[model samples]
Target: MWTNIQAKRPVWLAGAAIALAALAAYHNSFGGPFLFDDEQSILHNPSIRSFSTALTPPGGFGFTVSGRPLLNLSLALNYAVSGTEVWSYHALNLLIHVLAGLTLFGLVRRTLALPVLAGRFAGQELPAAFVIALLWTLHPLQTESVTYLIQRAESLMGLFYLLTLYGFVRAATAASARGWQVATVAACALGMACKEVMVTAPVVAVLYDRTFLAGSFRAAWERRRGLHAGLFATWLPLAWLVATAGGDRGGTFVLTPEAFAGYWLTQFEAVARYLQLALWPSPLVFEYGVTPVTAWTQVLPYAVPVVAAAGATLWALRFRPVAGFLGAAFFLILAPTSLLPGITQTIVEHRMYLPLAAVIALVAGAVMAALGRRVWPVLLVLALVAGGLTARRNADYQDEFRLWQDTVTKRPTSAKAQNNLGRVHFLRGELPEARQRYELAVSLDPGSAQTRYNLGLVLDATGQPEAAIAQYAEAVRILPYFAQARLRTASALLRLGRPAEAVAPAVEATRLLVEPAEAYFTLGQAQAMLGRPAEAAESYRAAVKHDPAQAEARLNLGIMLAQAGELAGAREQLGEAARLRPQLPEAHANLGIVLAESGRLPEAVASFQRALELRPDYAAAHYNLGNTLLRLGRVEEARGHFTAAVKAAPDFEAAREMLERLR
Candidate 1:
């Protein structure tokens, strides 16, 4: 609708309006919880808990291969203030999104100064800039970048990306004694730290020099020599940092130069896909997986739009946009992600967070220019309507459950969607329904580890421990260091009374990841079973150290201490276990046994009484209480408990004999 507002005052007002609209649209994100990979990337991570780990290359977020230190540093800063509050994490993401919007507005405004795109605005720089910024800020597709807290790396990186573009464009047009050169390069480096996407930024800088600074090929090359020397000089250190940080090479998928070229060509189709979505954003999904670039139907068919754009670029060699920044900036910033050899799959909504800004700006400015003097009202309507839609979409990200539920509802055949939705159901105790969804997902695609792991969890819950073990075994085999599968395998083993056999897998898990409290607890139980009481105690201690809520570990540790004759330590550990799990009938019953043996008869009787209070029909507690009373010389009381125990367990020889002795 934007084809009018070609004036400075109107543009300034539109910029302010976009700022307020974006802020209002996403304010609810302050309550969004950690979702999806946030668990592995942030919550369960040990390194992020401490400041020292924040600075290292493989730092601040545990020792995983994901060494985005700048991202870790931002998370570390978030942790320093509030560890896991949903509001704090969401607030940080919102701040980054809003700030990136502001930077995008600034970049657009600065681009208007260049001769190429400025003429399209018919001499009005401000109007074209406002329309671009307004649309970009309120686009519904960007909700993923803002609402998914962990993906703030994209939004935050975009801020620096736009800053680098603005400074470089201004430098090329103004040339100002090269003073801005250092700032431009520094911004580029920071952008790279924020995300590896900045690799495409240098290309954008050259395009700005070509289109705005000097358009002819020879002049652009001549102008680029000194800037290239200065720029690449700094990029050498950035390259080193990137190497130290490391990235997923798609495991042999990224090793080929031809594959890189194929990837770039495929992104041509991807760009067309993005354009299609911009026009009609239906059936959107947060995940598209590593979508294959050149499907048989898509290879020939998708080339139509890409070919058109390419031909347009060739023909438009004589006539360029006034800002001159849109084509090169869009192409430049987008190239690393869209053209990279191997990284993510071919399509993801989050990838659009930065590039869409350029595309939207180009479209909005061009639309306003074409309408000639009536675009202001239309721009306002577009911002308001888009902002409303974006706000509506963000409501889906309120929780993982809601997000995936929406996904499955929108894309019923999407196996990933079904699997994630099943995970939400499983987390909330709808086991039967979760199993139903997981089975559907498996039927759709058996290759996904996430689906298999989820199905394993359901099987384990339904008492099919052996089947669950098999599922987890397969998952771990596929992804050897996958912490979830390894932990589940150990848990199933423990449940099947094969805890001793679980030691190997649990050890493997710890060697790979210093997390999984359940694994450590299960390992301790297995060690204790193998006659390694001392080692078991240390394992239990580590388990409780990582997760203070491990009451079972504490009680087990206490029992081992009692058996080892460490009476004081046994009582201390058991007492803590009791305090932690008041309803644990075994904890109270065991406490009574330890106390009676320690010569605390009155305390022993009371502990037994409490165990009875919690679980009145507990046969073991009745049997143990009967024995404790017998030791205390309460013959009558002992007989009563013995009678109850025998009634509770009809095959109880111990209760029958104990009652006979009392008589």
Candidate 2:
């Protein structure tokens, strides 16, 4: 018993070390702000803002499919605990990554300790597995998936993916494997909910059984036919998810021959690039610019090396089945994204979150096999270097400015990166820098409607309305469905006093489902400018109805209603606006005017006084208060207010007339 306890010490110590190292490497990333997709998928995604909504299928929160319900649910859980604080989300992502790493350690150790590989691994299984897990955990290539908040979709799925495999391995070797088998199936199902990549988990499980447990596919199938069936059946949910989800699958089976060849060639290059990054792990970028191969000549250079690598992997399957398993698992996990035709992105580093496990495992196995029992020091050095690189990479994600700057530096032609970096500068009010980045982005990707729209925004802000209108029109021409661009175009046209021209785009803007409130508000502005009061009033009403928290919309709607002689409706809206934004003197003054119109003298006086208190120099509030007081028969008070109004606004003709009438 004493010897057995002593023998287990190194494993426990190594496990603890891996956890600590992972934490230390990612410590700077705990406060990193959300970047890129995080805005749409986590922050602005209302479905994940509440537990009930998150658990239910996304109704209209812009999440087209409820397929990633589990990922959404985890984000909701994080929100509940942190309420939009960046720290908690990053903490959860790190925790998931650590757990996945620990699971990888267990799975590798168990696989190497099996009877078939046991003699070969001898006493090195524990340390070998520890090194693989530690190195993989600290690998800089993993920072994108782990430190980037939205990519929890990848890391969380990876955790469950590894858990399913680890549980299956334990079950295959355990005295009673039934419970473990059930847990494995459950884990696979959970992984499916996290991401579609998990569809490969069952197939990998089958391969693992063949390589380590049963020694042959036929014997494994015979022994665990029911288990195999159950594992395969887990794909049913994933299939249903893909079928029901709104995803970009257009490039799959329908790609034209030219397009297919182009995409296929691009994928080979992408895979080669991924492997290079995995080995070196320097200058990891958030986005890469991939140009499709339009001609055979464009693909030939990449094709030879890619084919040779694939051939080597296949040869390993015939001669060295274990290495073959790792190679096959790597390809299988990547096949969905790489071989699949429709994905817009040619390569994404986070896609390697699971595939990297196989790479690290194979490398560690090779090192251990060559060095025998003397690989510890070399492994330690690799871990320290990887950990240092990971920590530095994590530092890049500490802020959007750093992250996007790094992306632009690494992939200068990535138009999206340039556009996003421009947005960061725009948010910080660095207009010239923002303009420079936006211009660069547009030049790099002339057809990108988003970059055009962003450029239009900066141009409009700098008072170049004509130039801004031109950019906006180009954006609308490039993507007719871009409702925001249409609205911006209308706004710029209105600024240029072209209300009639603005009307068409403003009306078109109202047809979109996204940000209907803003669309309606823009439509109302255009209609009002066209001197169509009734239509303007209706559009303003629609704007307020869609987004009641829109104080400006409510104020505008109330004023329009008052002009349309709907004084009672105007008072209600104006009062709500005042309540929503008490700091706005305009809200209080407008509410007062509506109250006085409806014959509520006391409420009108109080509203005007509140407006004046917020802004003592408010000439309109003072003039309105005087009229309300005179109507209430408070002659002395009315006279005093009228005099003050006239004094405050010496050029106020309306106040002068009211004061003379009072005297």
Candidate 3:
């Protein structure tokens, strides 16, 4: 019934349907808050703060944008336009998805219309391609790439990947193939910049050439050697980016033979799980984590079938090239992430972003072949169902709390999920809930430094300084470069008044943290607590050097300077502290002491008055004001302040002595 209607429709109409379906599926996702990697890649990424450094993403941080300069630059564009509003990022993600869908539609339609397969698809290419594109775009499994924000690295690369193939198909068929070939290379290069997954694109392009255009690899290479060369050349930039990005994509890659073997052994189950989700799309997890199946017995059941399918794909390359291309493309697209051991993530749905295309194409072709003219209604129903599921999945991403909660519910054993959920609770000020979650996460993954640090935060917030320090110490012991943990350990020690213990961690924190002002300030406090005035003053000076606006550090520096007989330096720091924190009475009181010692009696009186104005009952300020007044020969005023000082502090022996002498 609908075959007749679909046959009458042009490709643009089909594209419009795909676009509308994508929009409907993700309309609720525009308001979705940034989650997980988004915080590092988008929110805190200084590289995205300016266009000048857009191509030079922050490295050594394992950020999502670390090695993907194009992804980082794209985020910079979003940052320039909207800062951290998040809606702009989501909008760009949807645009990339829609563009990818349209590209897929064009690629499929044109591929079907090729002379080789035209006899079978004939007039139904538009509808068949539309079904594939629409279903793939609306698949609930894609919510991770579309709705999770930072995973734009996946969808953006997927777009360029499709364009590369689409452009190649056009180049093969066009009368003047030069422009299409260049566009194909450009797309491939851009894809490489988007993600390492694009390394498979060049291989996939060659495979497509062999399957559809050229009869064999030798013929395809001979005919389009230049195009293939250009495609492979793009790998140079990708290689350089990866190498310069700490050669490990920010420590995600684990290249040891044992790690590789374990990760590879786990891929059989991961691939099976991906296929299951592609078919069922239920209980989609945000993060599967980096747990590897070291024992072959655990994955043996999946390994047998997966190995068989791989062997069958190899065999089919000679006899059934088209079927082999689809199978190989799926496996090849997944091979980089699957074969390479990424210590950060093992099984993620977003890794299936492009590979899902091959799966859909295979399934759609089989369904179309089976149902023929009756396939239109079935495809339409599937598209609607997929769209509804996608929308429902996107709802889980509306807030970090909901997303992590959903992930924890689905993957109860995932320590990463529990940690992220605890982070959400921590941010919301739900200390008890956050503490419970963090404790569970720590117990689940005792070796996770990040979880340990997070548990420390919850412990510290709940007033358990010793426990917090223990967790922080464990975190730094595990990941020595963890600057924040080092700083937190020192802070917790200082909280317990263990200045000697705090000094070493505080000093290490100063060396490890990028912004070490807080560490230096904490170190100054520790030094002052231990009666090391000179060292304390130097630390405070270093803190002020890093952050000139730190009022507390300035106040501490002033006190140290005054005690060390640097009256002029003390006065300057105290004045700046008062300016920086006008509401702080301590700043004014310290400045008064420095001024009095500097022989500026009038200024000292005014400073004491300012301190008393901010805090009328400040005992120290009253006593200091009394001393300054007495020096200025204002005996009655001095007597009144001495009385007020004694009232503010009944145990003020110095004020009582002065009062008695005055009497």
Candidate 4:
């Protein structure tokens, strides 16, 4: 019993060390704000804001087909618990990552202890597994997947992938391991709900069985046909998800020889880059610029190492099957992204999250085999260096400004990074700085409609309406189907008093499916400017219908209904607008006007008071309140309100005339 306890202590201590190291490395990341896709996937995504919507098929704003239901559900739970505080989400991401690292430790240890590899790794399994897991968890390249809130999809999927493999290994080792086999299949299904990358789990598991447990593919299949069949059948959910859910509009499955060749060549360079980063792991970037290989000459430089790797993998399969298994796992995990065309991004670090496990395992095993007992001190030094680097990387994600600044610094040619940096400036109200960044982004990627639109937004904010309109026009020209750009053009035209010009783009915008509410609202503004109240009212109603929480739309619709003598409808719309946005004085003031018109004197007085309480300098609210008070024969109060309105707005002739009359 004493010997058995002594043998178990090292494993427990190792697990504890991994957990503590992960927490320490990610301590700063817990406060990191949402960056990039996190805004669309979590922050502004209404679908994950509620439990019911999160559990159901995704709908509402920001629902991308890449919407992983299980990942979304986790985010929803975080929202429910902490309500967008950022800390809870980061904590959960770190927890998932730690669990994945633990699972990796278990899987690798079990694999090393198997009959096939046990002889070669005897008495060194624990240390080798611990080193691999430690290196992987602390590696700087993993910060994007672990610290960036939105990339939780990658880490979460990786966790399930590891769990599935670990369960399979456990089942293969045990005499009656039906429960472990069932757990493995369940884990595969769960992984499918997390991300599409889980599609490779079943294949990797079968390969693991063939290489380590059953000695060959045929033997593994022959022994566990039913179990293998169950594993393959789990792909049904994944297939259904891919078919039904809207995939990223960027990637395509269609393969042309030319396109395939270019993508394949680009991936070779990417693989070389990944290997470099895996070894050095410095100056990690958030985004990488895509550079496709258009010619064979461009591919020649990268082809050598890729070819060497392929030959080594083939050679290992015949002589050293374990190495082949590791090699196969690395390529199989990377195959989806590498071979796929239209991936938008050619190289991304987070894509290496799963593949790194195999490389780390092989490296750690080689180191242990060579150094024997002396490997622990070397691993300790490496882990400390890697953990320190990881912590520093997490600090870069402390906020969007720091994150994008670092991204642009590292990847200066990345238009996305420049544009996002511009967004940070724009959000801070530094219009000139924002414009400069936007200009840089536009110059870098002249064909990107988004960068052009971003430039237009800064131009409009800086009072250059014509220049803004030109940028918007360029954006629309570049991407003719861009509804938001058309809407922006219409808005800029309206700002420049060209209501007639605004009408065309505004109408065109309403025809597009994207942001129809915003388009309809812009159309209503243009129509109202052109003296078409009836059409404007219809457009406003459509805007409100599409987004019920659109307080500005509801307020405009109410004002239009009031002008059309539909007082009851006006009252309802204004009341809803006020309820939706309690802080908007305009909503309360408009509600007051409709109430006054409908002869609800007491409610009108209360609404006007509420509006004034929200905005003490609101001249219109004061004026409307004065008129209501004068009608109710509150002579002194009416005079005071009229005076206040005239004081708030010196150009208010109506308030001046009303004050004189009241006196």
TM-score sort, best first: 2, 4, 3, 1
Name the top lDDT candidate: 3
Assess every candidate by TM-score.
0.87, 0.91, 0.88, 0.90
**Higher-TM-score candidate of 1 and 4:** 4
- Can you write out model 1's per-residue Cα lDDT over 11-119, one digit (the tens) per residue? 5566567667878998777787788767767787666788898755343222322545677788888888999877777778877776777777777777666665556
- Tens digits of per-residue lDDT for model 4 on 46-134? 65777888854443223432536888889888999898899899999999999999999899888888888766766688888888899
Sort by lDDT, top down from the best? 3, 4, 2, 1
lDDT of each: 0.74, 0.84, 0.89, 0.85
- Tell me the spans in candidate 4 whose CA falls farther than 4 Å from its real position: 1-9, 55-67, 246-257, 294-298, 476-483, 498-517, 530-549, 576-585, 602-623, 634-663
* lDDT tens digits by residue: candidate 3, 1-663: 699777556866878889988999898999999888888688768788889989988775548887899999999999998999988999999999999999999999899888777667757887888889888999999989989899999999999999999999999999999999999999999999999999999899999999999888999999999999999999999999888888887667778998888788778888888888888998799987666685768898988778887897899888888878998998999999999887767788998888898889988887896678698788889989999999998888887888888888989888999999999999999998998898888887888899999999988998999999889989888778788898898888888989999999899989866568999999999999999999999999999998899999999999988888988888889999999999999999999988988889999999999999989989889999999998999999999999999999999999999999999
lDDT, candidate 2, 32-58, per-residue tens: 888876876776666777788885434
All predictions: root-mean-square deviation over Cα? 4.7, 3.2, 4.3, 3.3
Off by over 4 Å in 3: 1-9, 294-297, 527-618, 621-648, 652-663
